[model samples]
Target: MKLTYYPGCSLEGTASDYAAGIAGVAGLLGLTLAELPDWNCCGASAAHSLDAEAARALPIRNLRLAQRIGLDVVAPCALCFNRLKAGAKDLEAKGERLSFRVWDLLDLLTQPVFLKRMAARLVTPLTGLQAVCYYGCLVNRPPKITDAPTPENPGNMEKLLQTLGATPLEWSFKTDCCGAGLAVARPDLIDRLVRRLYDRARRAGAECIVVSCQMCQANLDLPQARISRQAGQKYELPVLYFTELIALALGHPEVPRWLARHLVDPRPVLAAKGLLEIPAPQASG
Candidate 1:
């Protein structure tokens, strides 16, 4: 199964580990990712707030590129997914009066035929770990932007987790915000937001949080030390990219390498549960 890929800025830079793991697992599962040529930023949150047209146009450009290539696009970032979905929904709804291109990556990947391949390609067996799937804000809120399913309590990630053999935790903060863009401006705000989400995940019995957004993962993983210092308690919850967990199930070689570069290591937990058979490799971060 081949799909056009939009790496966005995060995937090529800070989230390269995730991109690599995803690519590795795709190869192992016989899934092909064709990156859209000349793909640009999806305009993310800032663009949406300032210039809606640019936000829509950015994703539209890539969608049109994908259409020209005669393939569907796959965007791993939750923000990008939300933007693309939003642009596509608007285009389909108003019949081109919006003066912006239209298309969604989700529309392509979730087709019955492709979904069947994705389910069949489930390689990682997350048998023992209980994970809380985190979608943050982009994939759900702002009614016009996302409507693939009800923004509240969507189960796509949970279903995918179950199919990959992981126990999905029933957590209330699954769709809650991790204070993404506020990471730099209002670190305290993010601290509170992350602490709340972490508390919920812990209370719900999740050993880790499975994330599809780079900022969400970084906010959770990078700020734990400060959070612990401020709160006088340690919160060492593992933040695993959804793709990284899927790679482990697919039996990819880079899992260990990816784990090592994390701010909070997940190896000991997987090892303690006797699921850590990933042979260590030279760190690649």
Candidate 2:
């Protein structure tokens, strides 16, 4: 499977580890993600608040570019996927013609086809791992825009993890807002939300919180120290990108590189589960 790939700003910057995992796992899944040429920003957490048209323009231009390549576009960032989906709807309203589709990388990969290859490619299944799949606000909210039938309790990530031999713990905060976009404007709110989410995950019996959003990963991972300091309790829960876990399960050589990019290291937990050792390289089929 081949599609146009849009690595939004966060993917290249804060979410570089996510990008590494994406790159490593694509080959294993027999999927090709061609970067959209001359692609630009997709008006992430900021644009729509100020001007609707201006926000739509950024992703619309990207859609047009994907249309040029005549392939479906895959955006790894939740915000980018949301923006692109909204932009496509805007174009549809204007009676504009386009010849491609936009998909969230998470939604795209969980399809049956990719799911089939995952089982075969499992060099090391995360059998003993237990985590809460954290899907932040933008991924499946506003059901009409995202076309998510089960937006309330989407099991895409859970299903994927089960396929990889990992147990996904259930938690009510699966689609809750992380308040990451408001970190600068209202850090107090971010702290409160992060703390609640962390407390909930811990209470749910999860060893970690696995996420698909850059902002969620950053907000959840980067603030644990401060949260612990303020609350006078240690919250060492690690936040890991779902892709990183996949890459590790697939025994990607770059797995260490990807894990190293995390603010709160996940190696200790992975070590405790005996999942830290890199499997020896295997020849291609």
Candidate 3:
């Protein structure tokens, strides 16, 4: 199936691995992705808080562009997905009906046909790996815009994890906030939130946290040492993008390159579980 892909800013920068993994998995599944032309930011966490007009307008611009293409839009970033959906709702409220549909990539992947395709291509199932699926905040909250079945607790990622042969731990804080944009401004608060998530996941026997949001991965994965220090405890848990695990299961060649981008290296845990193989070094002339 071909869809218009809205990668958002994170996918082009810090979260390029996520973009790579998504592309890899899509290729493996025979899904075609056509990027939206000249797409702009969807005005994430700060926009709605600062300027409501710009917040709504920015995503609406993209929605209009997708409408022109006449294909469903697939946004991999949770923040982007939320903003686009919000824009669509706002336009609908104003009676400016949009012709296209917006979908979170996870939601699209969870459909029965896609899941069946993924199952057939699984070469390395993540057996024995215990994980906590983190939804952060914006992905499924404000149910009207996101249309999530259970905003307080989402099971899409867990279902995908299970399909990949990983054990998805049932835990609290599945839909809890991950300190969002405050990661830079009030790290003290962010630390506390991260600590709570990590502590709970560890208690639930989760070796890692899997997430669909770039912000959650940045907060939980990038600042582990600082959060550990602040909490007076050590948390060496790996925070992985759901796409990365799917790519691994599909035997993507770039898996090692994508895994190398994580601040909290997941290879040690993956290797220990015999789920990862270190690529052989290239020879020099």
- Model 3, residue 212: C-alpha shift (Å): 0.5
What is the TM-score of candidate 3? 0.95
Candidate lDDT (C-alpha), each: 0.76, 0.87, 0.88
Global CA lDDT computed for model 1: 0.76
Report the number of clashing residue pairs per model. Answer: 5, 0, 0
| Cα distance off (Å), candidate 3, residue 22 | 1.2
lDDT of 1 by residue, 108-201 (tens): 3334564466567655467888889887777667656665467888777787677668899898888888888889889989999999988999
- Kindly indicate the candidate among 1 and 3 with the higher lDDT: 3
Spell out the clash pairs found in candidate 1: 123-249, 123-250, 124-249, 124-250, 125-249
- On residues 135-243, what C-alpha lDDT tens digit does candidate 3 reach at each position? 8877797999998899987898999998999999999889988886998899889888888898899999999999988888888998898877776777799999888
lDDT of 3: 0.88
How many angstroms is residue 176 displaced in model 2 relative to the true structure, after the best TM-score fit? 0.8
Which whole-number lDDT from 0 to 100 does residue 256 have in model 1? 86
Give the residue spans of candidate 2 off by over 4 A: 278-285
